[model samples]
Target chain A: MIKVRNMTVAYSGQPIFTNLSIAFEPGKITGIIGPNGAGKSTMIKGILGLIHKQSGDVTLHSKPVAKQLKNVAYVEQRAALDLTFPINVFDTVLTGTYPNLGLFKIPSEKDKSAARQALADVNLSEFSQRQIGELSGGQLQRVFVARAIVQEADVIILDEPFVGIDMKSEAEIMSILKRWQMAGKTIIVVHHDLNKVTKYFDDLVIINRGIVAAGKTADVFTKENITTAFSGDLSTILFSDKEPEHA
Target chain B: MRSIGLFIDGLMQYNFLQTALITSILVGIMSGIIGSFIILRGMSLMGDAISHAVLPGVAVAYMLGINILLGASLFGILAALLIGLVTLKSKLKNDTAIGIVFSAFFALGFILISLAESATNLHHILFGNVLAVSDNDLITTAIVLAIVLIFVVVFYKELLITSFDNTFAQAYGLKTQLMHYALMLVLTLVTVTALQTVGIILIVAMLITPAATAYLLTNRLSHMMIVAAIFSVVSSVIGLYMSYTFNWASGPAIVLTAAVFFSLAFLFSPKQGIIFKKKIN
Candidate 1:
């Protein structure tokens, strides 16, 4: 299990959240959904130690995640990467193995083969030699996904992985996540689409600066919880039978 | 062509010619390797800032009777550190921070130069006179080159990962802060080594142009470094030959040769050349 205890997260001295606690069960596909400015991304980054948390304990199996960052694979938002950098996709994917390779060690042939296999799994085997900038948005996302697969991490965290991606790539990524779940790995994703939340995730952690509800998708993904999460203004549109993107 | 051959032979005959040729080539190779990272990170302005930022240190070193390279490297790193600090502490963007620090250091350099007018020649420090290479200068350049080369080779993967995606670097426990400082240290060392050959005014061009030209030609970082190094060596050799034959200023000649190569690459490179791309209907 992954546990976040009594965490207070702040950015530039402004508190985003206070006394927040959440637990993620093992071998589950978890979605963190929230409105804008709700600290959805901030919460994940805080857990990863990418952002400073004012006070918190984020642990996996009762140990701090910071001490075992190698056990985690993270794919950041697409906008966070430099697409025009002069590195081929193969080299980019190979970096996933770097944390495990440790200091002053190069990737071995086994590692290269593992990276190649991950690329093949993502249906990007032929595009390994292409520059990252030449790839379409969906293809680039899959490339990063392939990198995460090569990491062989116990916990995989993806932020906004489906935005701007094609439906085919989305299906492919979902299937890949399913396969990882079958292997008993933990998958945490930050998502925005309310329509697919229950269909895609087994567990949902809903928030709007603080946790509104968190449990199995069927139990916690309710009209009242979502209404409270988005506030009174969005409740009508959110509960409307037809799905619009949540605010 | 005959004059070129005679020039090569003449270069072989004189010890000063040999020293100037060897030092310029070394400076060219080192600059190309380090500059590959600079252009990739889109830190061209930062490169310019650090190169110019070393000026005050050089002037101060002259007054204090200290080794100019040591002083210059310290100030170069100080400039980079200050630029990073300002960008973090304030809302100013990187280029704005660069502008503020580089111009201030450059202005301070001029003021110090005037104060030390009797001890140094401003022209030599500004444009460089490559033919006046001292043995100690040669040794210092060589040592700095070796150190920069070794670090780049040893940490090539870490550097690549950090430069490509620093957030991923941080998430994966790559010590990106340390990688950044290490790169800044290498940049300072490269600027210090190029001080006597390219001088402060044109050192940034020497650092950026070759790598940028190679970037136009290749899609891979390793190939970029190799192609840039080759371009650097060829341009340095031809520029030195031109300087020897025509009595031209060596620094401008070298930089101009590099610029010419960049122009050619920009116009005719098969992959990314602006002029040669097939137009859409």
Candidate 2:
């Protein structure tokens, strides 16, 4: 479980998030829904202690999140990676184990075995030796997921993991998250698609600059809440009772 | 046949040959290690500029009768730090800032060399005479190469993470700026140390060729460093032999041998090389 209290992040005197508070419970898939530049990624980064939060505290399992790097795993957006580095699928997944291994020691046989098992979980065992650059977008995303699995952390934060991925990969990722939730891991995913929130997320944290609403997905998916969170204009277009095509 | 045997005997007895071999190896190791990071960060041109910019530092030091390595390292470090800071702080692009600093520093060195032509042999400062390498220069180069290698290995993870994704590394609580400056410092020292053997015109080849060849052969950073170091040592030895046999400049001969390795890597490396084509079907 993760607890964020009165968190505010700023960059160059401009506040990215102000007076935000939310809790991500264990054993549930929590989807963070927001418009572009609405501080969703910043919030996740703040919790992971990746950025300097102007004022706030993020706690994981009753300890400061900053001190618990080993307890958390992160899957960055695929767009942020360099695909031409010549790293293979296996090596890419093995990097997730680095924080645990520290600086000096090499990856042991156990670590290699764990990486292989993680690949197997994603049905990518056959592709372990393939060059990362040769993989498709969906396969790359799955490789990142395999890395997170190999990390075996208590909480996993994925930033826009589904972006540019096909529907099958997206569904495959959601199923994996569902299984992770069942195994009692806290999952926080930054998502853009409003349509899939009801189907995939058990808890929804709708954010626009700050926490607009945070609770069960079914209760928070109301037309009024959607409209309020997205600033009424776009929400009306998405949640309108009548199809716009008929009009 | 009798005259040739006498000439060979004289050549074998010269102390300069031993000095050249040791100096070239030390310079090769330093340049190869530092050059790996430079090429990885896409700062090869910056390395070239810094190497050239040290010419004035050497010229000034020779004029003042000071240690050339110390003087040139001080200047190179200053230039490198200034370039890094300016690029990070200002809106000016990195390549443009490098161009400006490189041209200005090199031009200043040329002017100083022209002024001090009456005091010393300026041509030696420019092209360098490997046959004239002293014990002191060899000792300094060896010390510098060892220091550079140790520092790189000790800070391997931090350097790798920072070089790969600076913003992410900073977010993860690593000191991105400090690491950046540290790499620049190492690069300056490496450039200065290499200048004793390779000179400014050929220093870039020594710095970049081994690393570029290693890059074509390996994907892992640690493995790449090992491969680069091996390539550099072999090329330096081969180059020295060619220089001795053909009666040519050691610096160009070493660089030409390294270039041959690079061309071989390009043509025959397993994954990305032109000759080793991937199965696309």
Kindly report which residue stretches of model 2 are placed more than 4 angstroms away from their true locations once superposed.
A5-15, A49-57, A61-64, A231-247, B1-11, B52-75, B102-122, B165-168, B245-247, B267-270, B274-281
| DockQ for candidate 1, C-alpha atoms | 0.82
Residue A99's lDDT in candidate 1: 83
- Which residue segments of model 1 deviate by more than 4 Å? A231-247, B279-281
**lDDT of every predicted structure (CA atoms):** 0.89, 0.81
Candidate No. with top lDDT: 1
Instruction: Report the lDDT of model 2 for residue A128.
Output: 91
Candidate 2 chain A has its poorest 10 consecutive residues by lDDT at A238-247
Across A1-247, the per-residue lDDT of candidate 1 in tens digits comes to 7899999998878889998999987789999999999999999999999988889899988899999988899999999888888889998999999989988899999999999999999999999999999999999999999999999999999998999999999999999999999998889999988888989999999998889899999898877888888766566665676445444
Instruction: For residues B1-281, write the lDDT of model 1, one tens digit per residue.
Output: 99799887888788888888889989989999999999888889989999889889988999999988788888888898899999999999989999999999999999999999998888878887788888888998899889988998899998888878988889987789888888887888888778777777988988899999999999989899989988988888888888888988888889999999999999889887777685421
Candidate 2 per-residue lDDT, tens place, B3-28, comes to 44543564579888788778877877
Candidate with top DockQ is 1
Task: Name the lDDT value of residue B49 in candidate 1.
Answer: 92
Alpha carbon deviation, residue A28, candidate 2 (Å)? 2.8
